[model samples]
Target: MFPNQIGDFKHIINTELLKSGIYIVKIQNNTKTYSDKLIVIK
Candidate 1:
């Protein structure tokens, strides 16, 4: 369950999460589908 055309949304999340010391687990894109997972370690 993901969204299409996630370029802008993905950019925003990447910027915010990177500053917060989060790691991007994986990104899945199937045709017009897109999904991503993030992890935060303290």
Candidate 2:
């Protein structure tokens, strides 16, 4: 993640329930699907 940046949409994500590891983020838009790796350090 970038410094001073909250999120792509400026929304806060609840990372308190996430463990320290790599995560998969999937975004689906109709017939399209976007995926990205989410790394959480906690």
**TM-score against native, each model:** 0.33, 0.27
lDDT of each: 0.53, 0.43
Write out the backbone clash pairs for model 1. Answer: none
- Candidate 2 local lDDT, 1-42, one digit each (tens): 523333442222335434445344444444655555465555
As for model 1, its CA RMSD to the true structure in angstroms is 8.2
User: Which residue pairs come into collision in candidate 2?
Assistant: none
What 10-residue stretch in candidate 1 is worst by lDDT?
A: 4-13
| Model 1: residue 15 alpha-carbon error in angstroms | 0.9
Supply the global lDDT for candidate 1. 0.53
Which lDDT value does model 2 have at 33?
50
For model 2, state the Cα shift of residue 3 in Å. Answer: 24
1-42, model 1: which lDDT tens digit per residue?
A: 334347544422455666778856444445544666767768
Model 2 compared with the native: what TM-score? Answer: 0.27
Where is model 2 poorest over a 10-residue stretch in terms of lDDT? 4-13
Model 2 stretches astray by more than 4 angstroms: 1-17, 39-42
